[model samples]
Target: MKLDEAKQKFVHSWGVLGSNWGINKTMAQIHALLLVSEEPLSTEDVMEYLKISRGNANMNLRGLMDWGIVSKEIKIGERKDFFKADKDIWEVARRITEERSKREVEPIIKILKEVKNVEDDSDKAKEFVETIENLESFTSKLDGIVKKFVKSDEHWFYKNMVKLIK
Candidate 1:
């Protein structure tokens, strides 16, 4: 593929992956644009590059910022805010992992804990509580692993995991 085609393919693929990861496609496209950009982009620039509406650009930019992967930049003698993405791929992946864990995993653990507290004296209730407890245990283990990954360097963590598995 040509350079431009490759870039377009990357952006499109990243957007699709983001959708699968519970993020909107446009938001991922915006991030992909910023990731490939040589300089920071203003909202207008992003809208123009992505051929999106001003509102769409602004909303997705805000979403990326909230995820801590996109940040605002100030150019000297310029009033307009430019945005840039965290160019480090590892950092970007780590931030997304951390955010997803906080948003999805933590709430699930809380819900499981609450549901496991159903106090009743019947086989059905006992089975329900037992299932919930098991789920809670599994989720808690995953939560710990995610937290550890979020806090540790990717290479170091994966190396240790490999050693443990071996």
Candidate 2:
């Protein structure tokens, strides 16, 4: 298949799959473009190909870099910085797992901790506290699982997580 056709399919698929992972479609699409490209691409090239504005390209590129999937590259003798996405799917997944743990899981744990510590003794407060404590337990277990997966070199974590959910 031609690069354009392949890239479009990838972008579309990634955009569709992105929502479940807490990333928006456009961001995923931009990442998909970089991921499949053989050469590093500048923001201007991305904007033109994706038909998005400069700001949109910039914002999404930064987000991809934050997720550790896309990296900025400077070509020799070229002033404009280019972006390249990670070629390994597993590395992408692992980076995403780490980032999601930090973004979604960590804050939830903090909230659960704070809520469980509330000093109210009323029945409603008691219920709230009990619920929060339970949440804290579950979230803590989740964090533990994520930590275990991140430490290991195996792919079983993702499979086990899916199993755990099922």
Candidate 3:
């Protein structure tokens, strides 16, 4: 296939994968477009290419920036803003992992900590406390692992992953 065809396919596939990972399809598609582009693209360019509205493009671009994967590019003497995706795939993965842990895992852990502290002596309370404790234990471990992965260099993390796979 041609380069354009391959890029379109990749963008579509990435959008689908991003939805599976709990991101909006349009946001993922915008990220995909930025990732594959050789140069930074303006919001107008993105909207035109993706056949989306200005509001939709702008909203998703801001969301991507919040996720720390996409960034705004300010050009000299340009009124409109351009955007680019971090080209380093490992860095992108690390940022996404960190963000997901913050947005999803950390909040759940906080709620578990709060709710597990109920002061009662009934059987249902005992079972509830036990369940919450187990869940807190598992989530804490998962959070620790995610933190370690976020802190470690890509080489060390991948090396350990390879060893585990082998």
Candidate 4:
């Protein structure tokens, strides 16, 4: 494939992958673009290249910044703001995992804990409580694992995980 074609394919694929990970396609595309860029990109550049409205580009750029994967750059003697991706794959994965766990897992765990605290004596209620308790237990464990993974460097975590599996 031609180089441009390959880059387009990568951007599209990354957009699709982002949807699976709970981010919008445009946000992923913007991130993908920034990732491959040799230099920081301005909002106008993003709008023109992606053929997206200025609003769409701006919003997703801000979203990327919030996710800690992209950041703004201000050049000297220029007023326009440029953006760039973190570029380190390990750090990128770590940030995504940490953000997702905080945003999704923590809320689910909180809801499950509340459900487990309900007062009821019926058989169905008892079963509901038991099921919720189990879910809470599993989620708490998963949260701990995610926390550990986020805290440890990637190499150490993967190495220990491999050792434990064996």
Tens digit of per-residue lDDT, candidate 3, span 114-139: 99988999999999999999999999
- Model 4, residue 45: displacement in angstroms? 1.2
Which has the greatest lDDT? 3
lDDT by candidate, in order shown:
0.91, 0.87, 0.96, 0.93
Model 1 vs. true fold: TM: 0.94
Hey, what RMSD does candidate 3 come out at? Answer: 1.0
Weakest 10 consecutive residues of candidate 3 by summed lDDT: 149-158
TM-score against native, each model: 0.94, 0.86, 0.96, 0.95
Put down candidate 1 lDDT per residue, 1-166, tens digits, no spaces.
9978887888889899889977899998999989988899999999887799999999999999999999999999999999999999889889989999989999999999888887698999999999999999999999998888889997898899999999
Predicted candidate 2 versus true structure: per-residue lDDT over 95-149, tens digit per residue: 8888889999999998888768777789999998888888899999999988887
- Lowest summed lDDT over 10 consecutive residues: which window, candidate 4? 113-122
Clash pairs for candidate 1: none
Error of 2 at 85 (Å): 0.7
How does residue 30 of candidate 3 score in lDDT?
Answer: 96
Candidate 4: tens digits of C-alpha lDDT, residues 128-160: 999999999999999999998889897898899
Residue 132's lDDT within candidate 1 is 93
